[model samples]
Target chain A: MTSSTPASAWSRDDTGITVTVSGAWITSRLDQVGWPKAERSDIAGQVVVVDFQKIETLDSNGALVLHRWIEQLRKSAATVELRHPPAFYERITDAYAQSRTGATSPPTGRWGDSLAEIGHRAIDLAKATLHLLSFQGQIAVKLAQTLVRPRQLRAKSVVHHMQAAGVSALPIVGLLSFLLGVVTAYQGADQLARFGAQIFTVNVVGIGVLREMGALITAIVVAGRSASAFAAQIGTMKINEEIDAMRVIGLDPITVLVIPRVLALCLMFPFMVIFADALGILGGAIMATLALDISFGQFLRQFQTGVPILHFWVGLSKAPLFAMAIAAIGCQQGLMVGQDAASVGIRTTAAVVQAIFFVIVIDAGMSIFVSILGV
Target chain B: MPFIEQNFAEPKPEMMPAVRVRGLRTQFGAQVIHDNLDLTINRGEVFGLVGGSGTGKSVLVRTIIGLLRPAAGQIEVFGQNTQANSAAAQALRRQWGIMFQDGALFSSLTVSENIDVPLKEHTRLRAADRRAIIALKLQLAGLDPSAGAKYPAELSGGMRKRAGLARALALDPKIVFLDEPTAGLDPIGAAHFDQLVLDLQAALGLTVVMITHDLDSLYTACNRIGVILKKQLIAGTIAEISARPDPWINDYFNGPRGRAAAFAGAA
Candidate 1:
């Protein structure tokens, strides 16, 4: 690769043309540096000299160049002589000579170095992983320092994340949770109709949406929204060295950066869950009122009596825990970023994956604990 | 008591040598950066440690500030062993500040917010007081008042360095660690940085441990010079080292670039 480039890059004085491989249409070497056609032409009227010396390597280009010149020279009744060629080039000519006599030799340049390129890439990735670890330490120190010393909150940033995690999320969470409630109510109304127990549909839909599905749906929505938000935000900061700067100034990025976002999510998630639950329950009530022919007052009364406060608080408690898990995973992944753009991508992937994994595992455990303890 | 009597009889402890690093050694895997390095920087002195890339000059300064842990050796800051995780070691470090090669200013934070960070974290100053302090420090560092609202990315390279300097001296730190403070600057910018360092040192009464390869920086600012080579710090006064024939020093100072810097300074 190295040698072949310089060969074609320079021009011979007599021939005044660059040499590159063409005939073989593969990795073929040039055998020798024949005198540039002029010297030989001067020596013998029919003599032609082609400089294979500059043709260290050739593809179709060298072959075409040779073919064109040789064809022209042959028409002129000139004989071509080869000069000093590399050993590899001699092997090529010898094989061509043998092949002309029906001799056997394998071909060159059939996807060569593909496996080597793959291996080289794998080794680079592994080395990069090790290099990334040092950067993690630098980031961790920055986090620690930022923590030891607290700084003013970025009102703009906090508001931005707040709007994304809470304000913007309202429609989606509202749509899904509310629709789930309506479906619950519709199904309940259908079941109760057989026994003339249609009014009980209000209690069923209300309790179900508010207690279990409301919180569950809210959490799932947040796992996708806020968790990923944390990952992208922290990851961007990591790539840009904002986290490191935070440390130099003795500000704990985690306590300052992560804590605020986590805290915001913690406070907002449960409220969002409640808000989503209210919307969902209202949706269920609407479905019930329409299907069961139950009035709003009747539906409200049934719902208030059926679902206990314990159910409400149980789901709300998990919001902060989910917030903690998301923050920890996202910030940890961000701090793990290296000195390159790829590290941010890798860490962001890790953040989302880890956040979702922990949220599920912890949520399941919490649900069980709450149920077992009769909360 | 008279001012002279008070100054002489009970000299400030900073003047008694603020940062003393002795027999410092650190390594990353098989590569030993600093070994058996000893350095003592007096208060109000701009001590320059110069060496080529990978010569451990930066490593030595980082080791002093407790950024990179030393594999072997003792670092005493304000007469306390800084390597230990004791309260005293941490307190000693609080008296020092560092400016990294790239300025290392918080891109997300505005200039005033960046400078106000140290005060907000360490002291119990009111927000107004902190703002006042930040403004004063910014003024002292030769940065404009309006720059406080600008982020690191928004500022010029020279402005970034100045803002970083303001952050470093925000708490009136006695010892300032500078790692390639003037690196990546144009000639005029670099000269301006060197003069700013001199002005800062004089105004703040700071002891600076600067890791730099800029020959002009060494001449303009440093009181004592040190070279980190072959995993050891060779320290001497500027004149003392000029008289010596150390290969690294010869190559650095007597080399073409070094001689050119000297000639420029002379002119």
Candidate 2:
């Protein structure tokens, strides 16, 4: 077998210009060479022939490139023609050309059709936004009522949800935070050593983990794990008509399903933040002692002095808000699920994406507010 | 014209059954769905498989199509064992098509693209020829040409089913398996579908195995009925099977719904 890169050579004479393409004219060798550029003076109003008989192999991509070159030549009034192209290449190029032309020439009256479609989508988005706001208001009112009548709260269900979302999620959150802390400490040690301030690596790891990394990492992890789960579970129940069944029996699905999950997340987020914070600090301390020749006791001492108590409080304070956003987005998407198996999958994915996006936006807002307040 | 020879007929090679199953056993965990079941479906006929819910009617069809493995059984389709997964079995698969319940159309592709998938895989036809075939298939399946551009999610229940049927018939298979073809259609729509199936069967000489609980479909479309009861198949012409003394069979064919369907079919 011959192993050679694809190349094209062109020669011009009184009759015409002939371009011969050879070697593997396929996508894998697309980077090797391109078609040779012909001088306009040599081929002006002259017959041009592209010979593909010497080509070893050609695929769709190569055919498309060649087809475009031929089109360019014809557009320039060069009277171009292809010579001895393989049957498969001819078929593919012809098929692609037909589809391209067919797609480009839109049928009449399609403009009106597209305008109506855009109008429909705009209305749908507006309706969804309004519905989500109204749902949030309804949840606030329900929570207020529960606060007034304390006995209306489902305590057992709340506890169960807390265990599932918090206790069950502890291992993953701890492991991720520890890894984050170790990475930060190692990177900080290397950069600080270059500046002749290696001891200050402890402060970098300490303040960063406490003020931002710990809370952000835990929130993102919980959003991915628990938010999708909540959506899938409720969406499945909606599909089974269990939510409708509850409504028929005079029970509010929001009160029975959404409230417990939201309340549990709100109550558990602070505890998860504290656990994540401890693990993150411990990981930083271990990395510092092993690689930077700093003792564990010295690392802890620097952490205590360099990182203020307010930094820990600020990070902890973001947790409940992040948790509330994640829970609300998840349960709302689930409740809005349509009556099909496919909708469950769609809603679950939407829940995770929306939860993480909202968490990041909320964290940004909090950072700006705290900086303005100088806390 | 040949009465004596017809009475003592000899079986011809071309008249062999399309599908033959013997001693089929299907189970999930400790729950046995079918035990020692046997069935035969002849060529060039519409065979209706009827059973109550949870009776493994869908499982049996899936098993025969090699989607589910049987605990113990011999299932032969087009004279090749479907369980072997050999080249012959793979080739045999191209001879038949299965339309799942709920259409099961690819959610991403447009209707025309979905119908072209099998053609692209199995044939070397030109692009223009494939497009013409797609248009012809849409017309044959009773869909408008405009419907070819719509996604499966954008289609209504009836249109999705028609698009599914178009895809199933893309390869011009000799046999087609339909699961609950008329389950969610309106009466008029279902009747139109039945008539379409009948016309296509006669025109193309297709063998069909359909799972349906709709008694009207049984009376109007099926030439023979196979009832699943007590983990076994009792198959015959409708009249022959209805004459059996089984209590479930009696209730099924003689019940109010069944009788109304039978009367309506007669009318």
Candidate 3:
């Protein structure tokens, strides 16, 4: 036990030879020890024994190193025997031997396996979609019931969630929307100037920013920010058994956790749309004035006269639906989190992806419906 | 030649106590969990830390394992100050293993991979060798070799605790700390776990510090028990503790539940 370094000694006797391995024959010490290399000449027609009794420690690495040497000696016509292996070395050696013979390889049915895997994944996706839809229906019922009895509504929680999901998300939404407007205005100015129609850039920028880019950018940003945050917060509460505790205390998690968040997002999305629309138009105006040599007042007058008020209303109408989709998807994913720490991370990522995808799909449908109605 | 001879002739440093705590104080905002608490765990002893709920048993373990910083006082493991961010403290970490309540296994990693984590971090062993070690550690923890490929979530509560124990013992640590090792287990399972701890301790000469509420485990495995009360630790043998006149300790040990557990332990 005092020796930090592992060592071995060989002794020859009339009956056989004994190799006593001693002093921490662990994986970390294997490199330090000089492994005994047996020769056929010495081992032929004799018995060889490897003793591990004196070893301070013997892990799998040490056992394998010794087992291989013993196997070699036995193959050379020597009667090899292992003596006094540490408590679990026998099991380690048996597993190592079995693995060496490829007994542990996964069974192969390549084409069938691939087909089954794909089918399994498809079914899982369908099941997950159904579950999410059911959760959405439950939330809708809860929303209606609360609307019927407004006193039961958690107003403070709704306001708190608004501050978290909406107020805190303004800067990023504003920045991205402004950048989008600038890029669109710059690109449109190039095409319009080529046709001697530079003033038309204002109409293009105003319509695109007010009717599409402003609302779309804000939804995507909120989906990324608030959806993931809601999922992580709820998933952690589930893991900590706080959700169960809330149930025991006679509180509905949907009422306390889900409703407030969904309502907050729905209320905030329109305000965010308005704010982003202003910033985006301002960005377009600035670009037009500088890039096209148009005066600021001229750009403003053209933007105001060219973009119809109906287009702005059409864009604002999509905000509440987009908000509801994002919030519902996020809360549903959170509630679906399994009782494990890693499930929290997986569900959070899924919440963000699903929320963004749903938001885009809704926006596309809204755009088609508005155009069909001649808005 | 004389200098080399002198260096070679010096005696090795004596092994220090497994754990030592002096004037340890911990607090959370206005709450004081432990104030001026002191403890010493000698080498090669099964030390039990017992206390009422909310007495900071888990917190104390966390503090000693360097997870939580003490508000005041010093902790030393193997003569190295645990609070210092020094190389010696890093080396000292390899000397002890900890098993948390509920196993706390990484849900993503299979049982074998969980055991392999410490081996991979601390050694330069080949993959084959590491695999062999994983298998060995699994068997030592009384688990089937087939359990290696399963995730922590797949294992039952008792099996998860065994897997956690396997991971803890991976590095051949001199000391092992178990937080509530037998909680949430059936009597048979808890007894089996106790026997496993005893067998492993005997085989490895490990100094075990376990926080447990099971009186059966206390009577069966512990050589000494440290009770936490009034923000302080009172250490003694089980018999000594049972003899104390403190109302809580008296009811806890001589109560009907305690008597049944003691009888079971004796059997």
Candidate 4:
């Protein structure tokens, strides 16, 4: 098919330049022959002829390209005429002819557009934050109501969420905290070995893992995992009009959907933190025994004596706060999802990022408060 | 000239039907949907396939389009076997377009860009030329040119269906398959859509296969009707099929809604 087409060419004549095109001008063949161009300078003021007599095949794409070329020539002040065209040429050209003459160019991005966009985004963010805060207030009121009548809680849904957000998360959180403990103990042993104080590794691992790493690691993992999951699942339900149906059926989405998941995370998070702390300390002991030649009995004695019980309480207390922020942001983002599929993805991403950001911010604030009080 | 004339020209005995399905069998696991179904859609004719819900109307269309492999069958389009994985089958795909139910336009793209997708894939037309074609297609589909810039999510149901039609006709395909184009539309909108389908079919000389439950659509748009029953297809002209004594056909054509549509179509 490619070999059959003579390349479309133009010839000069006394009548004008006759742009002769031959062989299949169909879409597949057009790629090889390409759009035929006549020299604009030569035909600008002259009558140019588009001879379509020898054309073997012409589809809409071909006709469109021809019509576009003819329009371009006419725009250049050339009197463009079809010469020796077959009967079908008119039919094909007219079928694909553009009714809208002007191709409107997209608006160019001006410098002020960026500023305006930023302003718009800022307003949207502010509105979203206010909406989230009000939603939190609604959750608090609902929580109080549910407390008064505990039967209002959907126990099955709460159990399901506990399994998903808590049980399913155990392995990854445990693995990461254990690895964190091992690294902390190894690093502490290296530093203390220089001064023949390698026995201090137990105190370093116990203090670091119990006070900071355990709660922070568990919170970060849950924020990344459950936050995105919550946003996506609820956003899909919103898209499917399930939320609207729930409203019509007199079931509050906050009570039926959001609260159970949030409640489950709140109940489960402190346990996760405690579990992480135990595994982290165990990892530290193993690393100390292997690297510093410290006996398990000696490491336990040092940890019991050197690490304060207050450190465990400090970490465990932060768990519920972190869980609240993460679950709230996830559910809020899910409820905020727009009508389109792309918005679900955007909301899910926002849920994860904002949850992590808030968790870290809260941790920092708590750290400052703890430091000021010399905890 | 031959390419355009071939569409309107009477089919000689030597010419191939646009689509031919013979002894087709489709099953999902142990449950059979269609058994020994035979259907032939001639060139330049609007063929409507009607069946009750879950009667494998969609499954038949999907099997014919090679989206779902049939349990056993021979399906041919323009004399080329559709089941083959050869280059000819690839080229044959460009000869037809399928418009799914719900005007399944890409949610991310504007309507014009959705139309441009096929042109971009199948043709080497420049951006300017493709844009010109998109505007023309939008006009042909009974849409305003301004609608080209709006995304699918922005359009109403009727306009979205029109946009889907525009995209389907982007390459000027010889055959078009519409899956319930008029389903979920208001009476006026459905009538308008049927007229648009007829006008485009006449203008482009398309061989259209529409899977529709809309009796009004069958009455007005289709030249031939095929009813799927008892895992087999019974095909004939609308008048001929309506004449059958089968209880299902009798119920379908003589039902109150069907009678109203038939009367409306006649008037």
**TM-score of each candidate's B chain against the true B chain:** 0.90, 0.93, 0.94, 0.94
- Which residue runs of candidate 1 sit more than 4 Å off their true CA positions? A1-375, B1-15
The order by descending TM-score is 4, 3, 2, 1
lDDT of 1 by residue, B87-206 (tens): 777666657888877778876678888887877777654564465556566666667777777777688887888888889877667688888888888988888888888876764457
By descending DockQ, how would the candidates be arranged?
A: 4, 3, 2, 1
Best by lDDT: 4
lDDT score of residue B189 within candidate 2: 90
- Expressed as tens digits, the lDDT of each residue in A43-149 for candidate 2 is 67889898988888664445555666677778764688889987766655655544444242235674589889999999999997788678878888888888998
Question: In candidate 2 chain B, where is summed lDDT lowest over 10 consecutive residues?
Answer: B5-14
Error of 3 at A46 (Å): 3.9
Residue B40 Cα positional deviation in candidate 4, in Å, after optimal superposition: 1.0
Interface DockQ of each model: 0.01, 0.05, 0.34, 0.43
Q: Can you write out model 3's per-residue Cα lDDT over A55-92, one digit (the tens) per residue?
A: 87765556667776667678865677778776667756
- Model 4 pairs in collision: none
The residue-by-residue lDDT of candidate 4 on A1-375, one tens digit each, is 233553567788787787777777666666677456655676778877888877877766666666676778788746888887664556556655445545466788887898999999999989988987898898889988889999999999999999999989999999999999999999999999999999999999998998889999999999999999999999999988899999999999999998998999999999999999999999999998887799999999998899899999888889989999999899999998877789999999999999999999999988998889898
**By TM-score, is 1 or 4 better?**
4
Model 3 chain A poorest ten-residue lDDT run: A97-106
**Model 1 Cα displacement at A7 (Å)?**
84
Quote the lDDT for B1 in model 2.
86
What TM-score do all the candidates reach, one by one? 0.45, 0.72, 0.85, 0.92
lDDT values for all models: 0.69, 0.84, 0.86, 0.88
